[model samples]
Target: MSEDKSNRVVSGRVVSNAMDRTISVLVERRVKHPLYGKFLRRSMKLHAHDADNACNPGDWVRVEQCRPLSKTKCWRLVEIVEKAR
Candidate 1:
């Protein structure tokens, strides 16, 4: 039998709208500094697919990892967690 090995993709919200059909997602991670003992604020920008143009800034959303959608897009929006309020 073949084994399933699909990894769980991460989720984030749109942070910027500098490109067409694309949104900037701020992904946070905990990382200790070389001189510090506790974790610090670390973030990354992820390019996600927004085919419907429904995503907007300050809207909470869910994104999943997928095959490269474009030269810089590697994630797709799964759902809208919350709208800008």
Candidate 2:
């Protein structure tokens, strides 16, 4: 099947990779506060499908939105941007 190029993509660090073929990614973004107009850091944890279980904790990776692979997983591993240092 052809992959969707318009799918959302995010870069983050892999926080957990204990699951069989899944990894938890922590995506952080800075947003300005509505009232104060001060930029603040915010983060979210996303479950991404790792078909080969190639990701490990601390790895920087890119994930792309995809069809749901499980109850909480709708993202797929795209590439490892940087390895754990």
Candidate 3:
């Protein structure tokens, strides 16, 4: 049996460029402040694999944890959640 255990990393689309075979995914999460006790927006930039180069801006995509594709890319494009309208 294959032995691969990795947690999936999901993020929203902040920018998608097929020309460079990469997509800039924006992940947003809520975090409570230590002293303020209020939720704040926390965003992160992630690079995902785009084999077919089929992705555009403003598209929700799900990325799974995988080997590093580039220096800062450790996720692969699993599927597009919603297409840009």
Candidate 2: tens digits of C-alpha lDDT, residues 1-85: 9985799999999999999999999999999999999999999999999999998899999999999898999999999999998
Candidate with top lDDT is 2
Q: CA shift at 26, candidate 2, in angstroms?
A: 0.3
Per-residue lDDT for 2-27 in model 3, tens only?
99776876768748574477888889
| Model 1 spans > 4 angstroms off | 33-36
Ranking by lDDT: 2, 3, 1
Q: How close is every model to the real structure, measured as TM-score? A: 0.80, 0.91, 0.84
Each candidate's clash count? 0, 0, 0
Worst 10 residues of 1 by lDDT: 5-14
lDDT string, candidate 1, 1-85, tens digits: 9998775577666898678878888877779988968889788889998888888898888888888888988888888889988
Best by TM-score: 2
Residue pairs clashing, model 1: none
In candidate 3, which residue ranges exceed 4 Å CA deviation?
Answer: 1-4
